[model samples]
Target chain A: MNEHTPTPTEALPGAGNGLPSYLEQSPAVRERFAQLQQRKVILEVRDLQKRYKSLQGETEALRNINFQVHRREFVCVIGPSGCGKSTLIRILAGLEKHTAGDVLLDGQPVTGPGRDRGMVFQGYSLFPWLTVKRNVMFGPLMNGHSRDSAEREARLWLDMVNLGKFADAYPHQLSGGMRQRVAIARALVNEPRILLMDEPFGALDAQTRAKMQRHLLKIWRNLDITVLFITHDLDEAIYLADRILVLKANPGEVQEVIEVPVPRPRSPEQFSTPEFRATKARLEALIHPPEAQGEEEAEGEDALPEKIIRFTNVGDNVE
Target chain B: MNIRILLTYLSRPSRYRGAVFTLGAFLLPVLLWCAVSYVPFIWHPMVKVENPGGVDYFTPGMLVDRSEFQDQMKEMRQAGKPLPVGVRANPIYLPAPHEVARALYTAFTTAPEQRDAPWLHQSLWHSIQVIFWGFVLSSVVGVPLGVLCGTYVTLSRLSEPFVEFFRYLPAPAFGALAVAVLGIYDGPKIAIIFIGTFFQQVLVIANTTRKLDTTILEAARTLGTRGWRLITHVVVPGILPDLYRDQRILLGWAWTYLIVAELIGTSSGITWFITQQARYQHFENVYAAIIIIGVIGFGSDLLFERIGRRLFPWDRTQERKSA
Candidate 1:
């Protein structure tokens, strides 16, 4: 892993000084993620589905949720709330059971969780008794690493996430942003082939969330690790994903696949650019599709229907 | 906290020193008692204990010798200047504040051999023995049962009534039952401690189990962790800081039971020693024994706090940093 290098075509020279896109991320950090899509297929989910019985009737959380996460592909699933976006992410992480079909990781059906994958939950699920460093070391230590090796890995990951100074601090001592950073370091310390994040930064403030988004993007580019990120935020999906999967409600299934054509080392300032705005508007309309003139409102939301506002070249909605 | 804000934060800390200041204010009053009672005066020192009608009548004064004044009054002589109205009369009472301090200092520094063996036994070993035995009994029964109450649904349901029932039984009532069944001896003292401490420790273990964070436990099982690993690594650590705090409280509870045990148990303990002294013409010894008991109790609580700090350093840091 240490001997690998990025070719100029894969590098983002737009970053000042014509550096590799991954180098524009945390410098001196090792590339621990698997190679790009060319390496190997690590996880394959076939016809995966999960159903929940509601008071109204049986509600399908997911149906025919099929996707294969190639080695080192950053995939973001963006959808409406009842679209089973989060459930599919949990199933892929082995944190939730699939009612139909099966999940294969590293060529074996995922019977239960293994060290090969790590999950970052939406809420702060940190253990209160552990210091930041010890929390990071939890997975490796539990897997029976020697104390020294665990400490080394813990320190490396904490520094990678810019939390080296907080290793000895308890989770409560940290702000929401800092704690999520620790959670990321903790998840990545085990060097899982795929890191599953379920809206990990959803609780952060807007400014902090933006900072974390960029940090995550850097981490993704540097490590080239496959990420199964689930979020309802369309901008976040457009911002970070190489490809975004959109899901629809009522027997949830992927409705669209939006491939991001932008190069890496992208900045938040680009969000106002013409290309970015068009993509954002398209996603916004899809997630909140507008109703026909006389059609009834979306189920349970009598006030409004799914959004389908049209837009002009300047990115202003025309309808 | 910044140095500039230190004083702002510190003002509140110092305001809470009311307890320390109050204890200091009483020090001189206690010391006065250790002196005036021993010096000769025209009348009894203070608090005359009279056995005149076989039922004792006590008369308190600014300067009275309890036993001698009581003897003189029973013989139809004056005790001293008449005690003021609203003054409480108890033979063990010392009117002078300084005397109590002297008594306290004397009780602590006096050699064990210098005091009669029975007095020493009653003042020290008796209470210590009771508290020790009580803690042993509680741990022996409470912890395992608490674990069962927490981990297993059937055991929890079955044990709930017993735990709740026993927790409400007054310590003094338990002491009376012990006295009736075991008679005055080591058995009654042990029973007193056991009765006082057992229910609390059981609750500690049971509550810790019942409240083990469900999310963490779920995370553990999802990680392929099961059996002891699931219980020890996930469940135990998840509940440890809470358990340690409860353990510290348990140690203090043991000391509290000691005072209750000594007060009622017919065996040798500081409470028993003080009671016996109060009956005799020994007001000084009673005050002295009480001060010693306070010190012992405070010291035991402190010892456990120190032990908790050492064993659970994470909790200490969490407390100090407010994290």
Candidate 2:
């Protein structure tokens, strides 16, 4: 296979290189990388395990998951469906309990959901009854901030998401993309230490999704908060993350954490870069191994057996 | 009205068209009633006696079957006496629209023949109060219990089965018991209304509460909301519009039990007025009172729906459907 298609287990052709080529290409990128490495870890997940017990039996959803998100870093977790990406993010958010693990935020043990961790779900979760501004104010007000101060903070966050004009608009009035922006504002108004997003852009159309990715990256660039985004879209994970935490399915576990070689201050034009293609190829190999691909192809041929009964005279459309 | 617009299936008409249809809905029935009442050949099976000449049993203003009146006239003519005079009329029970319309006004103005009997408005007011207190009390308990039940599985398991079972037992069955325990007064009447609506309110509200998106609650939790704050800030507001609609429907259900409830104790309320007027064979007044009950029920529902739109301007589901 070409250097772009290195197997999951094999090191890249330039593995021995002291520094990734993209870092060497720009002094600003090198400096940013150094600063990122020096930043203290804001979120740490150690030996996280989750088991769901039902009448049928116990099913391990996630096991031995371990990762650390440095302050202000953008980390994306990508995996196939049912790979426990959502479970992982939920555990981090304290929305779901893990059977065994220590999720530490700034070295404080995370228990249940708290303002320290904010979450945005894929589904439009805005309170249908509240205006965009009120939805954003919910957190601060709930946490004992007076209505005036909460409103001020909510407006600031709404403006940050470029939805200042829509503060009075209801969720139903806004498009799907706009609703998610409001949701992000709602989450950010509390100024959480870490933002956990579970496929927050999964529901958007391709154009909207790309636009939101840019919007989110801009916000992340300007804010001091760290992000832990979960997505199955490989391109989305590569486009936004400082580092990509890959997971394999079944009893989901960490596959490999790839340091995105694409330089910081990223842009859409860099999508076709050799570094970007290299990282994407590595992810593809890890997620869809040759063995599985061959098996799927074999199954595709015989998965549909010859029908025993024909209800229509319509011949097979495919030649 | 455009027939093409009216006949379109599963499509909402324009606002003007909808208003016209609504008016027609009301006008059509009243028009049909007028046609039956005024058209002599349509269904006037009886005749009102104008004069009782040579007929010992016939009296002026009395209604006799058309065939019987004819036979009497034939007999009277054969005897060579002045024939009875009559005009086609409907059965007395089926009062004309004009009479009922007159009763709508006069029923309030007409004083009770017996001293100390409550006026029509007073009876209506009492019925309204019974409905109000009954529904209010049911909602006061039902809304919270239902919200809690929907939020917590333990509470749901503890209460839902019993609520489901109790709702199946007809509320009227508790009427005699309520009267026995509370008293033969407004207490039992109110209790009957309470029993009629409370169980259903709890279940319906619980279902509505369940329909609230769980993701919103989860989002609230991550925002540091917990304990009673979750219920007050998240659960309640999240389900308020749906709860408002459920309460409206439950209020209607409470109205359905009003007559049965009033009959349980000492006869009172509009139900009492209706029975009293019926006993005097003032069928027009009875019809007027019944229409008033319907008008009150339907009018209150419209008022509630309007208030709901104001209270939840953010809820566009209703607006979308109507539009």
Candidate 3:
């Protein structure tokens, strides 16, 4: 990974790495390294909780959640349905209010929906009435960017998502996959510090989903923006994440935080690699534990072998 | 004019059914009216007269001419005798289709006074003017207030009972009071149309505004849109297509109230012209005026459908089903 670091000529200004170029003199590199050691924490969530009260009764949605996302990190939150994953991302998007907690983005409290965080949803919630170009340019135009510049930015993102020809097309005219690409471009045009996705590919077909996962990873790497993705798909989390936050349901609580040691620029074939399988099996046990039954545990590590086999079987169906 | 070509067009084309159906829909009522008027030709009197005192014995097969029946009735009136009963009425009571068409042509082209007073087109123009102003005023007042009510639940609740209560109170019931407050010329007529449409428009437009997709609005809000900007940029555009449909329906309703409104305190609209012709027993002219109104209303509806389709081509919800 270090060998792939950008050279001095190739280094972008204000790139995610706050460190000065390592191609400089050794002494300068050391000084810059010392300065860069304090990497900026892009988002901080402390003791977040959500509660819903209806006429029938009160239900806790999330309880005592805490996490920090550093700059340029891709963090995926995986859990079962009703595990408050959507609620958590919605709150972070400033689309929902937290019951009690502090969510700080660049140390400023999130009061309501703002331009700092851009979100893409599983439903592909592009404004159907607007053209693809207009939908992508909406954020910039509303925030007072001149029309020309906003459209320019829109075109850039449209090209990035490979939907440049669909600028004038309506959402209904696009396929499900193309619409999701427009959604991604629409959110990215806002140029927010963090991208919040709530099961963004959950509605897509299997092939489209696989392609989108790859597309999203490529975009995420190029943009170098922090992302907090919420998905119930364990395979998706393992495939495209720096760290996976596994949540347990019944008033969702953070069950574990597993760091993937599988190297960067992950390919589709890596799903079968032993390291990937091992990581997935550990997550599977936490989600559906065989140890829950004492009698079943008498076989000693019985859960691990069966879970690995099931994971490999699921993996084989990916393509 | 090309019968063979039309037949070929109808028979050979895949999508000409709608054209054929539209032609039938227009021609059916006229054909029915023509058929009904020929009852005299098909007459074999059903009622037999049993001359009680041997006065001019009457029989069944004798054709009862309508003019002779009218003459007898006139003679009876002059001679102070009670009018005969059990006699079949004249089929002239329902004017034939050609009679109405002739009367329509005369009303527009012949009557000297038609130029100044309530000529067919003049009366129609007056009715359209009243309806247009009334509809515009209602829309001007209704759409924004409805948007406000939709955005704020407090305003919606406050106006809910008032709108609900007034909607059931018939618009015509206020005609006299409207005359008193707004006067006889055009004010009361316009007011009547306004009263008829405004309350319903408020409720409809408000519901439409409220029903805009929440996710789309949320997406807009996340993009730093808020307050008036939110309404202008997202909420307004989001609801425009639906509101256009609602307006089309409400416009038809406004046309329905035109006759009711014009019937009060003014001899200026198509209904007034019909009433004037009815006074002189000119049934043909009355029928002609009614047909004109119907044609105009139908034309207005076609116009609205065209405008709606042009403005919001994305509104495939209703049009696509028929298409």
Candidate 4:
């Protein structure tokens, strides 16, 4: 699985043209990458497996899932639908039990949901009854922080998410993107060692989703926390992740881990770069194989059982 | 308010218009009752005797059937005696609107003819206590049980089937047993109300609890919340608004059973006042007592609605639609 081309370290066409080259990392970024490689591993999963049983029979949802996230690393897991990405993130958050595996955070075995790991789901999970400030304060207060301290912490995180002005607003009053931002603030206020996000911006519109991506990247860069993000969008994975963990469907297992060739301080301008396109193409191929593509095309044809039965011929002359 | 706006289908009008419509709701019914009572040609089936001249059985202020009054007047006329005089009026049971309105004020001040009987206010107070205790007790026991049933599938499976079955049986069916066990006093009356509301309350509250978004619970768990704190902080507050609504509806249900419940005991509440006035043929007082019960029930519902708005300011779904 590691047979993919080595990380592109050589200079490309735009190197001497007074334009940033896609195949090269800046000296400072290279130095940071070197430091990050040496940083202690914050989370580790080994030979993880999950099985769901019903009266029909037992089915494997995930198998042999092995990965490690270094401290302060931004790792995105990209896979097709039904690839158990949500299940994997839930297990890491300790909200779900794996059939067999060891999940460790800071070298401590994760037994159940604890303050060490914070989670943000794809859906709007903010408590509707709580104001933005109180929603952020929930984690701290539950872990025994005094109300004053919790409120102080909540205010800081809310301000970080650019939602300090809406601290008193209820969840229903906010837009989808704003709600997700508050959710992120709520998760971060716990000061968790790692953050697990399962398609947190999937429900937003294209424009809002893009904005939230940049917002999250900024937050991740400033904070000293590791992130394991799950998404199906290749562009999103390439845009946000330092490394992308691509998984193959039917009982999901890791296919490869690609080091994002694009450099740090990622911007929307970099989306057209050769490196970003290359990585996205690779993910697309891994998720939708050539052999499966043929079968899917045939199935698509079969799905439309009957020809169109148009009663109106008004557009026939135009066509 | 314009009639066009008021008549618009499925459209909420302005607040002033809404108030006007509510007043109209009360006035429409009262106007129909007044038309039937005061209009001389509008089926006044009886005659109220003003001067009972030459009629052996007719007494002043007595209401006699119109047909019977006519036959007596004809007999008097044929005998050349001064004809009996009367005016069109509704039957004794259907008191005129003015008489009932007067009784509304006079019923409270009038002493009970029987020295041992309680006054109208005392009867009303006693009935209110029965309703309060019965409903409060039901909520205290049922709310927690319902929340538990909704939270855990095992508990729900164990209890909901029986609750569903029991709620179907009329609450008054337990009157005899309650009287035997709790004695012929407020205890039995309260028990009947409890029986009426408890089973229904558990089912309603359980359904409300189930409607609480599961994603919020999952989010709470991820935030290091565990065990009973999940219930107290997350589940309870999450369903409080819906639960409050369920209680309001259940309180109304409790009131529906009050008359039956009061009848089960020694008859010491507003029901007693109604029955006593009815026996004495003071129909105006009976109507007054019934209307007072309606006012109390509707007024309390309105008060609860106002309090609920204040308690859960964040819940805007219950807010009245704007124009």
Candidate 5:
């Protein structure tokens, strides 16, 4: 085995440091990788916990959670539906409170709703009374931007989503997908560095969800910002994430971190490859861990040698 | 003529929607009234006579030929008056329908006494004033309180039972309460109209607040829209369609209460005038007041509907579905 320094890019694999396994080309590139790895400490969650007690009995939503998100990384918190995924997102979004533990963002704990992180819910919560331009301009206007500049920013964002033509239209006039586009543009126009999306594509139809997924990837990759997305979809976890964090049911904890090894500008075709399958299989193993049967894991790890052989033979730049 | 208007109406597309109800209910009675009064096509015997003690019957007011009476002769001597020359049957009500209609029109258009005296100098003007006062007070008081009570759970919970209790109370009973509190003056009467509609307006506003789509509130919160600004930009707009609907309905209730308010005393208002004239046995004035109430209520409703549709085209689909 050999050692290698991490790269500045998160999704892309490291590809340098051939000199004595410790020396890189320049001090600057090494520093860049270190800064990318360095904790800008955008958000730090420490021993977070929430429990719900009812006549039916006490049910824990989260228990002793810990994580740190650095600047400009797409951190996806994926889990099953009732696995406290929504509860965790709601706490982060400042809609709900945890029974215990601290959530620190930007060196300060989140006390209430603020514009530091713009959120988009699964429901396209566009104000029906407002046009797209106004809806997008809402945050900027509230943050004390002049109406003219706010509208200009709104137009720019709408154009980014290819929805400039519908800026004058009301939300009800738009389809679900189009409305979601407006919501994205609205959230983006505020210029928040951290975008919190709580299953924002959940309400969309499957076809529209795929389209939105691609659009989100393009937009997200282009913007130098971090996204904390919560979703129950496993395929989505594989598709749009740099590194995926899975949460199990009852009390959500960071169970696994699965890095998607696909190249940038990820296409739907790349997902059918053996590398993608291998990564997905590892995630499935973590999620549904073979029901206490240790033999399956022993055989599964042995069978993976053929999978690598199959990958190089069948899936090398085939497209 | 009405005939031409009716013909033009029937020829248009989608005429049946109008024809199936409104025109039939409104104009059919007029048609029947006119047919019986003026359409000279049918004749029927008014009285029959049999031999004495052989089931002989005499209807006292059913004499068909009373042409040779003295008043008829006296009317013949009057310069421009015509004498009765042929058999004439008096209607069952004594006065024919056309005569009553002519009298109704003359009273409304010329003297305007029957319409004017009860309400104001004119029925339309007075109704407008009453409705305007009632509407203004209701909005000024009802809207802000409703917004406050709607948004705050504590305030709404504390006040809801009392508000609900008052909302369902009869408007006329409130009129009695007003009379007792403020005396029999016009102040009490108008106050009654205000009280009658206030509870309903508040209930509507409160309900609109409660029914606000939860998603918008969450979105607004995320957008840094909190406090008064949230109520202004998001909550208020979210509830505007329902508020606008309640505005129209509230005004209608105000109009209803005003008529009852007027009947409190034999001094003023269209109701008072109608009651006084009916005391004098002037049925024509009573009819005129009925017609005026219909005209005023319908006219205000028309204005409300038009303004409602024009300002809020988004609600047009809602209205159409409800219709």
Candidate 6:
């Protein structure tokens, strides 16, 4: 895994100028590479593990997970249910504690929650008691920003989300999609370096999900900020991410990391493209490996199994 | 005549139908009382015999007071008119509506001979003081403890059983103990109201706090909020609208114990005044005191409902719950 073998599509242009390789670039482009490398690493996860201790027994949620998200890159981690995808995002957000391994942001180990990272949840957890403006300003106020400045910052983000007219509306008064937009503005108002989203669009209708995806992509390009998004939708990952991380469950582990060959500023029509279909097929195959079928055939034959590990969640194992 | 004219004006749907209904409902009980008190008995002629044997009182099938009959006869003789037929008209059990209204007016207007008397205002003020102090104490003690119990599972498990057990034991049962410990003064009265409302407040507030969604708290944490800030910003505000509702209900419960509290120690509250009047068979005064109590309770409830709505404009459930 540490062979440093670059995947075939790793050379795709990311973020700024889409000029070709260093060997082909002029001296000025080569000189710019040094400066790019200076802030290359934004998040580093090494040997990450999480365990839950219950009266019944110990449950290993995630094991030996390792990844690095580079500066200003959009990365998506896609997995089946109970693959510890939520847990990994929570740890990155510093909302949950990991049992072992290290997670660092800008070379500093994450201790607990800090304002450096913003998080968006699938539930769209906006404070129900506050208006849209107040919800957006909550973080800045907590950080001791003056009321006027916080209000100004809140208005700017609300305008960015196209919800400027709803600054005085309570969360319950808004629809689910609109509420999630407010939540996004609330998190972004703090100006965090990285944004962590856990299935942010999973609860939205398909049309709304597509709209939000486009909106997020537009914002991502405009702000040039790093994003670590978690989801179970393969097409969504392919459409939105520069790189996709596939995870397998039952003591969840990283199965593979695939680079999306499609270029940025993605559109909804790209879902039908051959490149998108190819990447999605590869993920589906990895999720449901061929060996799983062989095991099923052996069970039908009533043959002696090589190992016996009875899991209560047999359906989960099959998935 | 004016009331009849006003009623006719209000009875029209285009006019004040609500006013007509309120006035009609208010008069219904008084009309029933008057009919029951005055309509059953009829007047009967009393034949005065010349037998000279104690002027044999010949009253037939009528409840007649002997001295009242003689007084009527004497008044007729002095007027130079023939003695009208003696008849019984009034019953003593239920007072007329006018009599009760007159009693109420006198109670409000006349200064009692006793010093520092508990008239309408004084009696109401006394009860208010006790209820106010008791409710304040209960809120101060119950809210924080309830928040702690709700926030921490260990504290909830440790305290909930005891709270539930004591809440069922009856707050009034502590009346005697309260008098013994705090003496027969304002202390016992306040203690009774506190005991009546405190346990329930704690349990209700804890349940409200516990019902707070964990997702919102996680959202707050990711924003770099922690410690007391988390409690003040997220937990308290999250449960506040619901907690305000709970307090309203608890306040009503507090009112229930006030009469019992006032009865135990000193005769100082409106309930005491009513009970004292009942002992003397002043039914009109007793009824007046009761009406006063009802009006005040209703007025206070309306005020609380208005304030709750204003404080939590963001809470749809609070608005619906109050309505």
Name the candidate that leads on TM-score: 2
The residue ranges of model 5 lying beyond 4 angstroms of the native Cα positions read A1-36, A53-57, A285-319, B1-104, B110-121, B174-177, B280-285, B316-323
The residue-by-residue lDDT of candidate 1 on A1-319, one tens digit each, is 1112445543333334432232332221123222344568877888888987879988888988777778778888888777878788778777678889989988888876766787787887777778999888887788888999999999998998998988887777678998888878877877788988889888988999999999998888789577989888877887888667778887788776655544555788767654456556556656765554244343455556457564546655456
- Please name the candidate that would achieve the greatest lDDT relative to the true structure: 4
DockQ of candidate 2 compared with the true complex: 0.50
- Candidate 5 collision pairs: B118-B269, B118-B270, B119-B269, B119-B270
Give the per-residue lDDT of model 4 (tens digit) for B160-216.
999999999999999999999999999989998999999999888989999998889
TM-score of each: 0.70, 0.89, 0.81, 0.88, 0.76, 0.76
Candidate 6 runs further than 4 Å off? A1-39, A288-319, B1-116, B154-165, B319-323
lDDT of 2 by residue, B1-323 (tens): 24335434434446567789889999999999999999999999999999999999888999999999989988988999888998999998999999999999999999987899999999999999999999899889998898888888899999999999999999889988998899998999899889889999888988888898889989999999999888998889988988999999999999999999999879999999999999999999999999999999999999999899789987767766576
lDDT of 5 at B169: 77
True contacts kept of 3: 0.64
Task: Supply the global lDDT for candidate 5.
Answer: 0.71
lDDT of each: 0.69, 0.88, 0.79, 0.88, 0.71, 0.80
Residue pairs with backbone overlap in model 6: none
**For residues B196-276, could you state the per-residue lDDT of candidate 5 as single tens digits?**
878877778888898888888888787777788888888888888778887877887888787777766434566665666
Q: Candidate 4: where is the Cα deviation over 4 Å?
A: A1-35, A297-319, B1-13, B47-88, B320-323
Report the number of clashing residue pairs per model.
Answer: 29, 0, 0, 0, 4, 0
What iRMS does model 3 reach?
5.3
Better of 3 and 5 by TM-score: 3
Task: Give the DockQ (2 decimals) of all models.
Answer: 0.22, 0.50, 0.31, 0.43, 0.26, 0.31
- Badly placed stretches (over 4 Å) of model 3 are A1-38, A290-319, B1-15, B39-90, B112-116
Q: For each prediction, how big is the interface RMSD? A: 3.5, 4.4, 5.3, 4.4, 5.8, 6.4
Shift in Å, residue A63, candidate 1: 4.5
Model 2 chain A worst lDDT run, 10 consecutive residues: A16-25
Deviation in angstroms for A273 in model 5?
A: 1.6
Tens digits of lDDT, candidate 2, A1-319: 0113335336543334332332123556557767888999998888899999978799899998888889999999999778999989998888889999899999999889999998999998998888999999999999999999999999899999999988887888789999999999999999999999999999999999999999999999899889999999999998999888888887999887877778878899988877777677768878878667867655764455545676656886555
